[model samples]
Target: MPEPLQIGVVVFPKVTQLDLTGPVQVFSSVPGARVHLIWKRIEPVPSDSVLVLTPTITFADCPQLDVICVPGGGGSDDMVNDEEMLDFLRRQAGAAKYITSVCTGSLVLGAAGLLQGYRATTHWSAMDHLAPFGAIPAKTRVCVDRNRVTGGGVTAGIDFALTLVSLLIDRQTAEAIQLRLEYNPAPPFNAGSPDTAPPEILAFMKERIAPFRQRRSEAIGRAAARLG
Candidate 1:
């Protein structure tokens, strides 16, 4: 028998809890998977939602993980300029079997220079930011480019995790897990995407996120310049 699979999910202030927890739940269900919630320290962290997550490991003590995942939210903006976090990711990604993210987490991976030349996806509003890191912005809910995998928006984490499990273990195992979780998705509204939303609704959504988008653009400019 071999060692259990080690999985690490990056936890941080204001991270969208669902983005982190959805995939964490799926991976934890794997037979030999051990998931670690990691941050700079072991402490309770708040999410954009009402949820509070606890980091179980510190970067200094974290073992090499089979998968290193960063989940996203407004906090992702803070992480773009976090040198320590970026350094840790760059180091871990150098040898991790899979480097991945959920939603805006890809922006953090991009900030760490891990997504360069890789095709990736993120929250629809922020997907354009990937270009600064030399990534091709994939227009799918889940995008996989070799060892790099990324998912779109918060709800997409479950789908991304299922796909990852299929690759890491087996399709049969993944299917069984999906069935066990009853992972069928049926949105009540057909407005999950810009293509499906009403024109006015889409415009309002864009307007709502404009300030964050502007800040992210500035942060990405700095992050990309540092990549040089």
Candidate 2:
């Protein structure tokens, strides 16, 4: 029999749980696919939300993965400037069949130089930051360029995973998994994006994240310089 498809997700402290969990659920549903949560160490990592995640393998022990995904949150601020994390991703990208990210995790992939010249997407607020890293920012829910796939914000992870599943397996299988998961989304409020949200609500959110965005931009500057 063929070996199972190996997939790895990099889990770090302060990750937005949904960004990781949503994709994991989709990836896990694939038959004959092994999904591994990886980190610097095999320890519980706290998330931006209440849920905590534990890594199944450390970076040192992870096998070459068919797909390597990074999920973003507050933790990504530090990750963008983390040489060790960036180094690990760089090494993995050399052989990983696909390199991907969800939410701000695309920023981490950008920092690792994996996204240079790739068209990618991230949370709306951070989309502009991609250009500094030489990434063409695509403002879509899911963006796929060559072997790099990225999802916008948190909820888009499921869409990203399903797209990946279609590529890795088949559309019929992806549809089956989607049906099994009851993935039809009919959100009560159509305010998920800045374009759809109320003007005041969008302003409020932009204001709320301004401080973090500033810090993240600064870190990205440093990471970009390092890449140069």
Candidate 3:
């Protein structure tokens, strides 16, 4: 039998837990599908201050992937600036049959120049930076451009993964997975996007993320200089 479709999920220190776990749960649920938690090293990596996940493979040991998914969070700002990480993303992206990202993962793709001339979406907070890499920033829940797929925000990872499964397998399979999860969402809050968020919620989120934005700006600056 042919090798099962291998999907690789890259993890790093301080990665948002949902970004990795959400997709892992979805893809792993599929029969005949394999998912690998990969990292720069084999040592367990911490997610925020609470969780540690042992990666299945390290950068030096990972097998070639059919689908590569990059998750996003605070760690993404650092990964976007790392020469090794950017180089790996550049190469893996070129060779993978499908390349996908969620939230700020699009930022990593942008840093590698993969999003140039593509219409992409990302966590709204970081969407502005796409233009620097020549991408047309989209304001949607998910955006698909040929072999590239990107999702918006943290929760969008689940939707992105399901969409990918639909793309890879079929809509029936995707709907079945969603049904199994009972994924009927109904949040008490009416606002998930910046435009729909209340003035106070938007203000609070911006203020909280200001430092991260500044650091990301500086890091991307350096990465751009190096790329030049």
Taking all chains together, each candidate's TM-score versus the true structure is 0.98, 0.99, 0.96
Best by lDDT: 2
Structure candidate 3, residue pairs in collision: none
Task: Rank candidates by lDDT, best first.
Answer: 2, 1, 3
- Stretches off by above 4 angstroms in model 3 are none
Local accuracy of candidate 2 as per-residue lDDT tens digits, 77-188: 9999998899999999999999999999999999999998899999999998899889999999999999999999999999999999999999999999999999999999
lDDT of 1: 0.93
Which run of 10 residues does model 2 get worst, by summed lDDT? 219-228
The lDDT of each candidate is 0.93, 0.95, 0.86
Model 2 residue runs over 4 Å out of place are none
Off by over 4 Å in 1: none
Model 1 quality (TM-score) = 0.98
Higher-TM-score candidate of 1 and 3: 1
Report the lDDT tens digits of candidate 1 across residue range 1-228.
Answer: 999999999999999999998999899899988999999988889999888998999999999999999999999989988999999999999889999999999999998989889999999999789999899999899999999999999999999999999999999989998998999888899999998999999999899988988988888788888888
Q: Model 2 residue 225 lDDT? A: 90
Winner on TM-score (2 vs 3): 2
lDDT of 3 by residue, 2-70 (tens): 789889998988888888788888998777988899888888899865889899988777778889888
How many Å off is the CA of 216 in candidate 2? Answer: 1.0
